[model samples]
Target: MDQRNALLGEQFGICPICLKPDPEHVDHDHETGKVRGVLCFSCNAALGQFRDRPDVMRRAAAYVEGNVWKPKLVAPGVYRLPS
Candidate 1:
């Protein structure tokens, strides 16, 4: 088994997400909530894409809604995307 995975198995006792005897690492975002998982890399990515910033995700949901958004970017000195 992988070193980190084994360490997780020995230390954490179970993967945080799977709740299985699988190994896991503690993950967290500097600007977000508790690091939520003891699963593999793929699961973490899925959670990030799904749960983080749901409003922005809703805006992205436009294509699924069959709506169109104009690309009107005002004087760009550097701006954040709408949420």
Candidate 2:
């Protein structure tokens, strides 16, 4: 097997982060163009969503950890906080 496929097998065809089986996408460094590892589509999308910034990712984690928003029930199937 080639290097990419080999890495995919090593990772068991699943995303290391979310541990979900998905078509493999190679993850790499945008700056230096260095190959990092293989990841699933969703996990790869997450890095893009975070703009590949560790600081932004950390802030998002902190926000989730803070749990600043609590769900409020509005209707049978609708739930939202009042503005």
Candidate 3:
């Protein structure tokens, strides 16, 4: 079988990130150009928007889950989120 078809079959036609079916786009690491997996269009676009930064993605996920950071005033015009 073709490698792409094999991969799609391995994923059961679902986007690994969003668990949506019929993921037609191939996702890869921009830095190394290595194939990561298949992803739906929206998820693939979202990764691009996030610049493939895992930290930023985690924060975004946290924000979406209502874990918004409450910045503490440290100094004049300086606010910091608790670590």
In terms of lDDT, model 2 sits at 0.80
lDDT of each: 0.58, 0.80, 0.90
Task: For each candidate, give its TM-score against the true structure.
Answer: 0.32, 0.67, 0.88
lDDT of 2 by residue, 1-83 (tens): 38988887888887788888754789988988887778888888999899789977776786789845567878997889523
Note the residue pairs that clash in candidate 1. Answer: 16-38, 17-38
What ranges in model 1 sit over 4 Å off? Answer: 1-12, 30-37, 51-83
Summarize candidate 3's per-residue lDDT along 17-69 as a digit string, tens digits. Answer: 88999998888999999988888999999999999999899999999999998
The model with the greater lDDT, 2 or 3, is 3
lDDT, ranked from best to worst: 3, 2, 1
lDDT of 1 by residue, 61-82 (tens): 7867977565656667654454
Model 2 residue 74 CA deviation in Å: 37
Candidate number with greatest lDDT: 3
